[model samples]
Target: MPPPGGTPDNANYDVLVVGGGPVGLLLAYQLKRFGVSVCVLEQHEKEMQDAYGRAIALFPRTLEQLDQLDLIEPMLQLGFACRTSVTYKDGERVVWTFMENIQDTTYDFVLVLRQMYTEQILREKLDAVGARYYHGMKCVDFTYDENLPRANYPIVSTFVDGGSGEQYQLRSKYLVGADGGHSFVRRHAGISFEGDSSDDQWIRIDGIVETDMPLNRSYGAIESKTHGNVLWAPLDHAATRIGYAYTAEIAAKYPGGVTQEVAKQEAIEAMKPFKVNFKEVHWWTLYNIGQRLANSFSVRDRILLCGDAAHTHSSGAAQGLNTGIHDAVNLGWKLALQIRDATKLEVLKTYDTERMTAVQQLIRYDKDISTLMSHKWPSWYEGDRNADPYHVLGEIFEKTASFNTGLGICYSENFVNQTSALSLRVPPGSRPPDLELSTPGTDQKVRFQHITRNIAKFWVAVFTGNINATRTPLRQLRKAYAGMRALPIDAFVSWITISASTGCSPYEALGMEPFGNTYYDATSCAHERFGFSLERGGIAIIRPDGLLATGGPLDGQFVEEYFSKVMQ
Candidate 1:
């Protein structure tokens, strides 16, 4: 494996990622795992070390997806396990149960880790896989050609080495901009960035702090008449994140503009009635919020975008970083499949369709939360002028609890998430319940996602409701699935037979060899969570990113039909 800041071994790659943040690093890592030649270009000389960056919360679904990458264990070690949320006004508790509504999965609590550590962990994984990301590299400009014979490497990207001030070119089959909001690639490529910017500016400071409020180590908010809705989040390593709207009136107090000292002072004032003292300051920022989405996420499908390059929004709901993670995982597998078989280009198209829909939903939610956090009603508000923004914030907050936590993000029908009877409770396009299962008779517990590792391949979960009742249909499903080798796309799938019956092995328990890998739903919780009958079995097609693609009865032909439509 090349070192973190090492030179690329080759100038040409199957995919060239333009940013080396968490999203780009993870996408590159996943593509490399699938045998795709991938490299990343990062403008920063190195990932952040001492200073923590903007994002701090990783919601439930984000953690679940990270677990699929086998990266969550390290992150959990560095994050604070925050379980509850509290809001206060003048030291009195205010009821807001929106954040407390997160349910299901092992990662029920939000993992509160700084963005710098998140990026570092991703880079470490990328390094272990030998994927090279060049540092101090800036993508200046580039052009593409389809008329020429070198159409396979359609996108030619030009970069300037930040260290040497030398310009160079690298060719790739695809160019992805995981770059930040002011993406050089997006602007240079002439992609339209459409959205509105709020005059509301907010101050967020990360530091070691002491606070008298209970649930200080968890998520907390304060209604400050002067500071608006104050943010009091407990971050990793005994750190507290204090944030408040840097209102125009407060800005007027410092016409020279807010300094780090000013930011620190304001944080203390924001948490009035309850005292807070900063022991150490790690990082802080004061900036205006905006919500922008690219008119298109892909330019001719060769020049694609993800993460902040495709969309930028407020940290109010903390969707900014979580959405980036979603974009990376969603794009990683699709791009890898497309590169492996050019005929499956449609799979790559679904990344844009899927993420754009999710992004639109996020933007609509952010517009309200961001305004509310600043103690202002959104433009759509029709209630009385005397209405409290915090009250309104509470109502809207509860409704979007599932989405804000990322557990309920469901995509529209597409090739990857095809329309079905939607029979299962965890239907196509929705995230599957990460219920616990066990090794066939060992009875050792294992998470459903652990069995479905993130290797840019789909996981076919054969839910055998009960061995005694469904053995015949299970065997028929296995034989029919075995016969699918003629299609070629079947190679991209991994299977696990989960039986509701527990025994020594598949042979001893079900009178059949393990279909692919034998697992026992010892408690029948997995079967129940998946909406599978205790007597009748079925199959679920889990996409590479962990969303259920399509599912139906235990009929191999049904499974084959899905793959045939999604891929050759």
Candidate 2:
């Protein structure tokens, strides 16, 4: 907890992540994977309770990002798949929403699992890499030195052990606040959490239940005359989470008494015509809702904020954890590159810009969804035609389906996502579509994401139309790759040749010395999905986080210019 007693030094750790929740754990995992020294600090003395009355929905986009770390399969094994969202009004199904694999993701539907389990899986990944995760140690103060020597640690963080009251000082090149809404790092950094709080309160229950409702098998909601709006979803084991709003009258009903017994009674009363029996209760909570975002995500190009520390919103939309996971993935690899000095300092700024844009959109969407679910219509939509709350919520859900599923998340055009003049189908700042391909001269098939699994480096796929045409670009790229050997660039950049020709092997054309492994777009899906014309071959640079960075003509100079902008 005392951080092993040391002064802040660059030789120690490159990055110090506060709060070992899912986001912090993920940041640590990625940094370690990138060979960057990282240490995690958790304020809690031990693992918190399964108080996962919080985030339980893992959208498809999140699963795709998790696949990059090879952690999705284990999570899929421990969670339930929620493909449909059913909403009922007065015990009759009114809006049944379906989330398909429209993005062509490996994990199509939302996975319902406790947040604790999600954190555990990420912690296991960190443990596998021998990363340090210290619990009970909380950051009490930090000092940022902008003028310090570049080789030395710029941020000096002090921590104290909750158990022994021992104090320790640690140093890092970067400090990240992944702590929750009441984050000390955010407050100490003097960053403002801007937003408003809503009066709508909610109570949630998770446990074994017996219900006559036929739609309880998956994600469902109920809009009742008596209960308000209730969320129904399956959980790990034979458990379910039933979350319902608490009206002013209901709050008054429990006025001198709000206990588990009272909550259970209220839950039963709210279900109206459907009979719901609870055999056991695992967890329950009563809480208010608020929407807030940090004024900035990163400070001085070093101190950063993520997860609940960066933003907060109601659980009604079930976006709290899902959005936080996105924040971690977006920032993790960027920070790793920054630590290695592989990317320009300005490149790290995109972490703040891109994620802030996404978080702000989430806030706007959550505001509408929360209001509708609470049966409180905003002033503009109060007419009889839009009277029904269930109908309105369904409409908003349809409109914002992309954000909800994490598929529609596309970063704004920036240094990293310049418009590709090559006219590829996948635009810069958007994730490359997942398509099936195979190794050169072999029948082994693989998903396009398989090539994108590594988070520490960028992958440049040279789509040469034929083996003969690959000779020049391959030779030039091999020379460029050799030039990068002197720098730590090899740690952050990789090259691969993808041939559209079935007659010749990509391995023989490029040789295995420079390009690690050649892949064949035999099915022609890659060619179509990437908008690659056989006449005009192109090179697509996939970022460390699996987003398309840039694409242009298949020339060595074009590849060098792309790397020159991002790497040292």
Best candidate per lDDT, number? 1
C-alpha lDDT (0 to 100) for residue 59 of candidate 1: 93
Predicted structure 2: lDDT = 0.80
Best by TM-score: 1
TM-score of every candidate relative to the true structure: 0.95, 0.92
Q: After superposing candidate 2, which stretches have Cα over 4 Å from the reference?
A: 1-11, 48-52, 101-103, 466-488, 507-515
Assess each prediction's global lDDT (C-alpha) against the native.
Answer: 0.84, 0.80
- Give me candidate 1's TM-score against the actual structure: 0.95
lDDT of 2 by residue, 144-171 (tens): 8889974698788898888788888888
Model 1, span 1-568: residue lDDT tens = 2345755554778999999888888889988888988989998876444265678999998998888888899999999988889999879998876556777778888999888888888887888888878888888988888775433687788888887887878888888999889898889889999998989999999999887878787698999878988988988888889999999888889988889999999899889888888899989998888899999999888888989999999888888889999999988888888887833678888888889999999998888898988988888889896878888888888888889888899997777787664367776888887777778656788888778765577888888887778878888886887687555766788788888877776777767776678788877888888888878878888888888888788888888787777776
Candidate 1 stretches greater than 4 Å from native: 6-10, 47-52, 148-151, 485-487
